[model samples]
Target: MAPTPFESLDDYISLPRIEALALSPDGTQAVLTVAVLKKDATAYERSLWTVPSDGSGAPRRLTRSAKGEAGAAFTARGDILFVSARPDADGEADDESGQLWLLPAGGGEARAVTRLAGGASQIAAVAEAADRLVIGAELLPGADSLEADAKLRALRKEKKVSAILHDAYPVRFWDHDLGPAEPHLLAIDLDTLEDTVAAVVAESDALATAAAAADTETDGATDAPADAGTPYPVTLPRPRDLTPAAHRTVDPDQVAVSPDGATVVASLQISEQRGGRFALVSIDVDSGERTTLFDEGDVDHEAPAMSHDGTRIAYLRSPRSTPEGPADVEVWTAGIDGSSPRRLAAGWDRWPTSLTFDRDDGALIATADSDGRGPVYRIPLDGSAPLQLTSDDFTYTHVAVDRFTGDLVALRSSWIAPPHPVRIGRDGAVAPLASPAPLPAAPATIGEVEATAEDGAPVRAWLLLPEGASDAAPAPLLLWIHGGPLSSWNAWSWRWNPLLAVARGYAVLLPDPALSTGYGLEFIARGWNSWGGKPYTDLMAITDAAVARPDIDETRTAAMGGSFGGYMANWVAGHTDRFRAIVTHASLWALDQFAGTTDSSVYWQRIFTPEAMTEHSPHRFVRDIRTPLLVIHGDRDYRVPIGESLRLWSELAEHHAAADGSTVHRFLYYPDENHWVLKPQHAVVWYQTVFAFLDEQLHGGEWHRPELLG
Candidate 1:
């Protein structure tokens, strides 16, 4: 028999990933984004794909291109409103201007609504009454000439600084220069496509106040320059001296405007300890009244959906986990007047991935993981019994409800199936809208493995034997650690396939230590402070047990992970040189340096006490590391920060040079990506680089691309 043809990485990675499903105003139609894969560079094409709520018509593709399209919605008359960034546009930012497009809901060509450009993103269709859209828009400098003089004055003030001695440490008493600050805000007319100065949120006022203090400190006395930008009108005037902590830029995906346009509901956290909070604020869209409906404090509340009658709101809330353990999450409802807030359901592991309310009776409909299988669920507004709409064992990550018919549109995938959008039949049957793509290459053998933690706690894990391997001989192994420590590799996921390593003749081992979720609250909660302790020991024991099998080679093993998993990769290298190659992604290298540079330094402190933190940090043990390493970071990742990766790379390189021994350590940075690599093009590049690095280290061959260096 002929051997199966060798499968390329492209084949397995080419399956489409769907995101952002929005129902039309009439609820009869829907618009969603589908990412298409290309031979060389995969493109994010968000065309308007329409599927009827009744599952009668075949899904039709409306827009098609390599550019990105997002923030889809339908007008009252069923017109599609969306923002598209077309590379085909000749303008700078490449049609990144995010021009608004209108397409007839009945099927017609999408046309530009207005010429306003320069990155107008986050488009939301207001109700039928208003001829306006709430968009996160930006204009080029030339659009507002009147503010030019104010900008110049502010720039001049910032340039004027006073340098003072004794503010520097660790170096000579070099002076520290402090400069003035300035803030700006504006509003744009959706109808006329004109720019106007809106009431300044207090973020800018703090800037002006800081500027005044700086001017006074330098000159020994004086008020801010009279030439400063004029204050907005009293009805919506710029706030004066409002604390910086009180204001924030709205999340593109999280903010919502009320039905009457008199309020803005936002999910926020003032500090690390405060956890997640939601504020249902009454704001005059025109006058910006800014009255708080309620400040629901010290719990996670997000993805709020207002009822049709506007008498109450529904939201998901989760208590923040403390260092001691994990916390349970629940669904909740509250009266608009801030009274009678009550829990509708409890024991939910996570939030409703997405939620929508039925207009006619205000029934609550949401897409969530219920009973270990992610599915769509429907519950009435009065807190009635929840009906599980889709009960397939396969995981459904997202769901959208039709506004008119209450039919559901959702994404479905399982351990063996790549993701595809599905339409739910009224009778509860499910069918895929697109043809199933080719399945990813499978491991030669799939097996479930179990191990006992140090305390005799049972741990579950999965092992994938390399394809075409013989039991008589040992094969190289790769151990993969998942991030989140809180997050577990679900039993039903295509990500478990070991095709990449299998093609290269290596078995893969994925072990879940004491901290992984999905088993129970107690099991997952154990990870809060188990870092470098029992959890790490469990991983080591699991590896040791797995390698004892006749088909595994212990010496040629490598390890890789991102985020918390990245931290483990570095930790393992420092603790022992058991593996030849280690690859870390978005890792926290030096805990001490991380404590200062990371945005959530407070979270680290909360998770681990300062003493435990200093003792367990990988940076404290870098001198003990002997394994070759490769590190990857995205420049725009605020969570882990690029500096952490850089610090680790530099430290390892210096240690090798000092010891007069060559150790390979390379760092790669993706300039435009974020914490999660979303772009299909960049994701492929990352996988290729990682594989190339590991292959060279394991096989000892000259890599084709020598120019790709640290």
Candidate 2:
């Protein structure tokens, strides 16, 4: 059977995505930002956007700039405040310090409130206090000298820093220049409308200095000579040690003020190696006595919220389990005295991304994605029905709820969509806020389907048929996979590019294989050890099933995915030759190398099993690859790292040898992109390159590549 062609991928690129939705104090209005990638391959330009809580008025754009804006909050007087960094400010880096800006909640010109240095990390309003905003600033971690010592320790483990002097890379690359870490938190008093360097939360001066002295003592040697002891004074002064003995280091993530704003409760992690997880403790900012409320050992806990009366504390806990499987994380409540610990009825979707308590209803409002994509859910403090407030095919990235008003707000998006703000009505209506831009209307034939894997396990999937495809002829098929081996691909999407794919004459299929999260706990673990086993087999079988339909052409098939999906794509090309073309983005090509190089080595080892490293790695099976493939990765990715993709490219070139003169191996690196192509322009460039690559390989045709921005 002949396969159908995808009309074009660009048609869906212009769809509107909603993100960063926040509610006003009155619960009548909300603020968010709409991002669109620009055409020059520059950056995404976001404007402050606002919509009515009732979905009455259209979303209003509050700012205009070639640069973008993000992280918005509503002020007490109902003014919408946000942060925007100018394009030229840092040569489109988005790293430029974001200046605080305020706009009328109704909508108007945004005026700068604070001229920041690096960037603002977080902001919160003082309860019951008007005109007061507490902001946190992120400065660099520590000086370069200290950083070098840390790097050196890391290199020594990798054999990159050898014991012998002549074997190292070179001194220039190992120079121990030092500078302060980019981000250190500071409290800003917004009411003064002025900034005061509150207190140095992390003082790395001693650590940096000690490292410098140690480096000087070593005379720039790559390794510590046999006489070298203590590994360059690795035991540097802790931030808490810098403070007067009375004051202790508050866990950075746990820095929260008591309801009356009198006490600060911070969670601190003392040692990662000692199985000492984060601890929630009270800090008398006034007296400096750091009292511990509870300590998380081997488990994870954070986002602690005090009860209305302040006698009880509610926090999320991923309780430590025996080294078997994932611990079911549930909401936990404990007394202020650290007694009477109780497990609330919260499920393990993810961490408490956001939590709030309704004063009037006495309900604990939580925004969790326990269902896979984040959505707002609510339960009573007394543990009533744990009801879901919002339901869609998308995940909620950020959410905020007002206690007094019961106003629930969320920012939601799906695999093929940009984020857009949606309000959960008290009556349970899911309504969109006034979108700053018109959303790309959904095409008539777009819908979802379910395909059975080889194991007869049902794989949930979405299908988008080409605009003009007829049942008379089988159409070309495009199979897309999602990243998180645990993440789910939902039915609702707005990225619109897939709609464009349909417009270009192809049907798009997104199947949620066994490892997808939404189907519940067991389903999520199906792809765990079965990385290339069941998950790969399921995808292939699903494709076979999809292609067997009268509407699809099996021979004209193509595949693409990012992250975990990328890993699967590489695996598919190596294991089978069914696909005409494949696109793998930000993929982990070599699991063995990933075991050693990834920051989450311990987590990976636990997830895949110790035997997985030797048995299931694609690096060990690279000699089997035969499909034409495109490998894309971000240079600045701290998570997956660029080396993973580079390793894949090098291996493909070595084995696939185009001396056969085939465009079978191609590598593309986005210098400024992260694991996900987040920026608007980069989003466009990504789709353009991907679609163009697919067009060339699948259709044997060339087309103008669309840019992310106009």
Each candidate's clash count: 1, 50
Q: What number of backbone clashes does candidate 2 have, counting pairs of residues 3 or more apart or in separate chains?
A: 50
lDDT, candidate 1, 13-34, per-residue tens = 5655555566666666556666
Q: Write the per-residue lDDT of candidate 2 for residues 1-710, one digit (tens) a residue.
A: 22322233333444444556777777676777676656753445676666787678776666777667777776666776677665432122533557556666565656555433344555543332345344444333322232343444444545664343321111111112112222232333334442223322122344455557666764556555432322221121111111131111233445555545445555555445412466777655435566878775576666777665556667777665432545565777777656898776745344445666655536667765444456666767676656776766666655666455556566666544456666666544666666675545444265566667776777767677764566687779999987777666653443324655665667888787867766665665566666887888888877877887888888799998888888888888878888999998888877777765554455665566657656677777788877788899887665577889988888877887768655556777788776666655566577677777888888888755454323
Give the winner by TM-score. Answer: 2
Which candidate tops lDDT? 2
Residue 291 displacement in candidate 1 (angstroms): 3.6
